[model samples]
Target: MAQFYRLRVHHRQTGEIHDLTVASDRYILHQAEHQGYELPFSCRNGACTSCAVRIRSGEVFQPEAVGLSQELRDRGYALLCVSYARSDLEVETQDEDEVYELQFGRYFGGGRVRFGLPLEDD
Candidate 1:
């Protein structure tokens, strides 16, 4: 039998709060979209941070969320496109830039050099 859980989403950009029921086996973003709530998303395959959210309470399983590191997942970050509700969930939508920064900001503007390029010699 499939289990259903209450999902509360707080949209930071629009200041909207959405309450919905989601099946444990379904993706939250997909469920939200089905119910006519427009959420921010770029890639629906969990390859980007456009659908990132922070888990305020409860748990989610997102084994396919490659956009987020394990460290960030441990810190309660999840990609809604690939996440499954493990229990009743409360999540706050995150800014795309904020989540991107949290994921790869350290590697940016660090004075790193490219090894293989047209203008550079190997």
Candidate 2:
């Protein structure tokens, strides 16, 4: 049986509020797109953080979201492109950079780093 759940997606970047019903058997982002909502997304296969969102309420299942870490998932983050509504859901789009930072910044961003090899003396 196909189950439907209410979904409330808030676009923090655009300040758009979309309220609609989504099906548990389909990806949330696709459903929203079918309903004419243009939410941020990139790499619809769930490999990028562009579709990242934070679940403010309710539940979702995203077993294919390889872009997110278990820590981020535990922190209520999900990739809408692969997430399925498990219950009435309330989510807000997250800044991609923020999500990226949370996922990998610890290993890279550590302040100014001199780029390129030292210029050869003339």
Candidate 3:
């Protein structure tokens, strides 16, 4: 028998809170959509931050969530598209750009860019 868990999602943009009952075997995002909640999401394959959320309470398992780094996951970040509830959960939606920056921001503005072709100093 499949176990179901209660999920509380707080939308950061609109301050809307959605309550849902999700099966442990299903992805949280998919289940939310199936229940008529319009949550933010892009890639449903766990390859993007569009469905990122921060675990506020309880736990989720997302071993296939490649969009998140171990550090981020340790910091309570999760990709709803690939996450399965391990227990009753409370998550807050994260801004995509914010999570993206946290994931790859270090690489930005760290290298020198040569606008034109490099001139050979003969």
Candidate 4:
């Protein structure tokens, strides 16, 4: 049996709020888009954090959100491109740069790159 959940989306960047019904079996982003609401997203395959949102209330299931680390997930962050509503959900879009910084800022390099292997002629 399929279940449906009410989703409340808070687009923080635009200050737009949308209330939509989403199914538990499909990607929330897809459903939201179909319902005529626009949301930030990139790399819909769950490999990027462009569609990241913060879960304010209720629960979402995101088994394929590989772009998010357990640390972020534990902190109530989710990638809407791959998330499914497990229950009535309230998610607010995160600032793209903020989420990216939180997720990968530490890994940024401050030094020049040095290659150990010589370039081969093609």
TM-scores of the candidates in the order shown: 0.89, 0.90, 0.88, 0.87
Q: What are the lDDT figures for the candidates, one per model?
A: 0.92, 0.94, 0.93, 0.91
- Tell me how far candidate 2 lies from the true structure as C-alpha RMSD in angstroms: 3.8
lDDT of 3 at 112: 45
Candidate 1, pairs of clashing residues: none
What shift in Å separates residue 63 of candidate 1 from its native position after superposition?
0.8
For candidate 2, the lDDT comes to: 0.94
- Tens digits of lDDT, candidate 1, 26-53: 8989999999999999999999999999
List clash counts for every candidate, in order.
Answer: 0, 0, 0, 0
**Model 1 lDDT vs. the true structure?**
0.92
Across 39-99, the per-residue lDDT of candidate 4 in tens digits comes to: 9998999988889999999998899999999899999999999998999999899998899
The TM-score obtained by model 4 is: 0.87
Point to the candidate with the largest lDDT.
2
Off by over 4 Å in 3: 109-122
Residue lDDT tens for model 2, 53-77: 9999999999999989999999999
Q: What are the RMSDs of all candidates, in order?
A: 3.7, 3.8, 5.1, 4.6
Which of the predicted structures, 1 or 4, would earn the higher lDDT when compared with the native? Answer: 1
Give the range where candidate 4 is weakest over 10 consecutive residues by summed lDDT.
108-117
Model 4 CA lDDT for position 79: 95
